[model samples]
Target: MEPVRLIMSGAVVGQELAAEFGPLPPSLLPVGTQRLYELQLAALGGTRQHLVLPETFELSAFDRERLVELNVEIAPIPEGLRLGEAVVYALNSIGAGDTPVHILHGDTLIAEPPLSEADVIVGGRRSNEYAWAEIDTDGEGRITALVDTRAGEEGREHQPVAAGYFAFGSAVDLLRSMTRMRGDFVAGVNHYLAGHSVKLARGGRWLDFGHLQTFFQSRLAVTTARAFNTVRIDGLTARKSSQDEAKIWAEAHWLQEAPPAVQVYCGRLLGFGAEDGKSFYETEYEYLPVLSELFVYGALGRQPWLRILASCEDFLRTCAGITGSGSGDAALKALAADKTLARLERFARETGFPIDAPLSFEGRACPSLVSIAERLVAAYDLQSGAPESVFHGDLCFSNILYDSRVRRIKAIDPRGLVGERPTIYGDLRYDLAKLAHSVVGRYDQIIAGRCRAERHGEDFSLAFEPIACQPWLEAALGDLSVRGVGGLSPAVRAVTVSLFLSMIPLHADKPERQKAFVANALKLFLQMERQ
Candidate 1:
């Protein structure tokens, strides 16, 4: 079967959504980590697609870059034309004459795509709430014609309407029909049907993102409505952008220059540049869930969690194998000692955290935050005399995604710095500590705002949503500990405490979150002191 190119009619102006979420097209509304258009591309599954735009619909730099990253070609047409005219004009302007093309509405996602066996397929569903093309069928149950509901009702009510997907045997017929209908989308379809037999495909999961409620609901169901990180994925490309240029550039560099052994575990960098003054980089995106979600979603009763841990262990071991032992103090000083101290000071200044006072929390006597951090830094210095391999500065469940179909985990958001330099080599123990910080320190829970901190000056109490998979997670961390991984390793354990304390400054917008980070750090520090 010859392949057909997809033409996404996405230039439809989203007046309501624009007023709510700014000037993003309705198609760009993010569901999960990817935009709605990315979901359409995934369902359609094509090498390339076209985004036909109204001439007045200007794209933001991020949107423009994302379209390019997804291999989607853009075609803008004159404004105020009917849908049929706009589509045909876009095709003609892009020089796609007479080619087999599948036209899908920007706001629609058809789970079951068009059947290529039929020369013409009109996807319809039994719904008339929204303005759509009314499907008219013959007595023999074949599609005979379509009427534009928005133009005039014409007494068509409660009939199967277009779900916004159309397939044609040839684009030439569409152009000729549109020419005859004078730019009426439904009329043009009916004109084309004078000779062509139309196949009616009904009853698949069709998602319409045009409505505000449905759009927000769908976006919430897949993932949080708000992004916890700067990474955006379209299942084809993942872009990590930040105002911090050096950090983003180093990440791209690490992925590109990664040793061949672990390169397979990294997102393949596609392109990178500064867009509108923000540094950004793109990599191939996948639809896999982050390990944090699966760890909590536990539908399979620990089997999936066990496999995820195994995959994570394999990844960490591979990273640890990248280099032999160096003196290790330089990386320790840069990544751990200096960074943790600096971050702790900032956390104190920003949050007025009692970092310089004696504290007793979670039933353990503790010194000031700065004192314990210094001691922990010394402890790491003594225990990490012979480092095993290079490090990924941030190695947590949120930064790692698992491909369950393949039983492998891929990593993203490498810290990309060993010490002062943005290089790929750092202390492997720090990486181990990071992975442990998520499990042993419960960092994901804190980030999700599930944790609470009750503080009375130097004393504090804390709690978070109980992890149902705590037993399994603890067992996995224990296994890593038994194998000399970081969870229970004295040096790595100290670094994990430092991680929790040092990261408090980053979540400045959420004072509650910062306090939780501080409490979690205190809890970990008390445990480390007992050891």
Candidate 2:
């Protein structure tokens, strides 16, 4: 079949033409220049002819040159002619008797091939506004109406078929009919076809670059289609120009601020390490410390006063305790057998801490420790069971922030059941044990480093040395007779050891390492039982 001749007319012909005239170098074409060069190549493939009309530019040297090169003809319509009229004039000048003319508006860019079977092809719905409305029908899909308007409706109910491109069997007949009707060529064609048989071809992807917004939108679409990776540093500037003022302001004001790095880093590490160790350890590990520093500064170090008060409260309320109604000895035996206490005892043993060793009954391991903790609670109960309170369930170097400038330790990341003085006393030793275990291997190094850095280095380590668990344990558990709890400390130690042992599985790369960690934790637990 002979190729179809494409004709286009519009006001912004210069800017919108190349997008429609496929495969032409944008830089080579002049404003308002007919892209006959590209059309000639397309004609060689199958298209028959091409034509363009710029209402203002009548006959130019560029037009004549393009006409000669394209082996086509040109006609200059008078000024003040509408695009539809100019299209009719161009169709007539080309001798409509010989070939089928395909009329396309300059603003439309064809991204796909035209239909081969249809005499008239139009683009499909490209936006929500132009969506086809479905009618409630009894039968399968059929074109029931060219246009339908409901009562009191402001607009037509049928889908709006855009008149961007259309072809006719007889160009002259169509043009003459359009001229006689005194209407736009599209309306004229639709009117002529009011009674005639016509077929509708499904449309392809057609982009309209008519307005400034659509022009940029189309450009962005094209860039995305071509997979061009373009980055703009001023995203807000581009967004503002695109008329998203709210988003522009939001991004400028809120989302651009620096985030807490430590939390971000730790969260990432936990997620990544759990999900993909090869990826996390090899690629993401180096950046963890840097991000963690931000968290330390912002959340941990900056908020010491809050941490200290909270820690003290938690210590008073959850860590101290009391024997309920039973014989203090029996209660102490049960406490010693408790799994949580056994775990702590095991933890002390595996980590090489003195908390797991046999005690001389009166110290921390004695039954009196529980009675003492309870008595401390009873004292508070006498004073209406209220005391200045705060608590950090997990109090340790990991959760505590040491402010070098102020020489104060701040606690963080509190957890556990918080309540009155008795309840707090019940969980006191657990917190202390947790703190002591956390500072095991590196406590001296950290204290020495801090002391050396202080200007008034009046043996700061001495003050911290007194706070260690050994003295506290000895004072609390001195003799076996008064030891209120038979195996409470050992049980707590076992639980702590089990938890630390479980952590090894998280960082262990080898199965043997994990097995070893578990075996060692079990041995520690058994030792707690013996104690």
Candidate 3:
């Protein structure tokens, strides 16, 4: 059987309908009413649909553009008296000859299931008995005459009720009747349907978005969906090339972007150099590609190195010290702080994953973890007055990316402000924590695989080593001190231990990796306590 042909009317019928219904009352409408038509279309497999709207109804340019993008056919009808009459006339003009047409309002989005053999299917809630008439009933509790009781309740003493939708078996006939009846169009259609047997299909949520309040609520719903699901391939690809590219894209286009001071602070902390002498726009353009690639690849599970790089970049930025001040600035700062860790934590909790257990360190603990912890405490103890610089307060895995092809790393999303040098010095341990957690958590599996692969003595570097981690950490920190934020070791041992402890559960899959993380965290905590 062919897909059902859907015709939508009443694009802005809600405004007038709501006014007619009386004063606006606040209430949470159904979720279906608040979602955008685009998302509804996606849910129903986009195909075989036509939308009809009156010219009087004002639709945003963006909405129109979106309709076009979704390949929806839009037909404009003359606006004036009996807008419903105009819509029926348009549907009759365009529908397939004599075919049963499914008519719905623009605000009503339905999830399309395979069509049943019934001649006509009308959907409504069984609970809305007063507003709906049970014309026919099967032996079972099934309903058949669920015709719209909208007009009956409209201006009545009872609470207002509406079917908000209708379906017709005789599309051509309904159109003709609508044109002739004009002002009495809806009544005529109901009269016509009364003579014919119509099947009532119960189920599906209904939303009425015919008011300013409903419209506002619907906008928020749409924004939430766009923020989470919208994909920008170009933006993602661009970020992989450079840190600046990712920063620009995240700040300017991505729903998340850090504030200017925070952005500057992050850069300084991460050893991105002073924003004073640099071209901000140029730097962002250069960085976006790198950041994008790192994010996409990391998400794809193609590169493990990104775990360290991203952590390091973000840590450095946060240590530098970029803070949120005003509303706009706060928004930017939040944008820069990558919330991946929080997201992962939530996901793990929801999925019932054990994420709060202590990690098991193998026979040997990471020496670097101890050394880094001690150094951090010493730096913090000195109370060295470091120059104020910018920082990405939430430096975590999600904000950083590592490009395997170039063997380079980049950072995106920054938060606080600090001296450039101090930011770098303090942030060095972040990457080490990430690496240790990953290696310790996944240690057994990685080692097993490496051992199997190197049975014939082939090279393998799957192990996590303090020796390897230290170089990158030191280099990044040193660069920040020398070129960006003034050199002041602001590294806090407590923060380092906390970071390591957080990663323990994430590395649960690898016992050795898990162990390493625990060992490191314990050592760091001990060092901090001593200091």
Scored by lDDT, the top model is: 1
**Candidates in descending TM-score order:** 1, 3, 2
* Candidate closest to the true structure, highest TM-score: 1
What does the lDDT come to for candidate 3?
Answer: 0.39
Per-residue lDDT of candidate 2, residues 1-531 (tens digit): 353565464333333332222222221221111222342333223435555544354443433564566665444455456655766666666555645556655555555435453345453443433322222221432222234334334443444455365655666566766787573654566554554344554454555554333443444433211111111212112111113233222222221221332122111111111121111111111101111111111112223333343333333333233223323222222222233344444444454433322322211132211222222222111222222122234454444433333433433323322221122112333444344333321232221221111111111111111222334332232221112221135434443443443344242334333333333333334444466
TM-score of every candidate relative to the true structure: 0.60, 0.34, 0.36
Query: Could you give candidate 1's per-residue lDDT for residues 483-519 as a string of tens digits?
Result: 3545567887888888887777887888888778778
Q: How well does candidate 1 score on lDDT at residue 202?
A: 67
lDDT of 3 by residue, 1-531 (tens): 233344455333333333222111111111221224554456445355666655455444434655677776666666554644755656655655665655555554445432443344444443322334334445643333333455335332332223334556666666666666664645555555556665455434444344443443333333211222231222112222223333333333311244453343232211122243321221232221122222211112222333444445454555345422323222222221233245336535654533443222233223333243333334332333333333333444344434333443445444223222112112333333333323332222222222111111111112332222334433443334322422222333344454554555565556555444445454445444554
Per-residue error for 504 in candidate 2, Å, reads 60
- lDDT for each candidate structure: 0.70, 0.36, 0.39
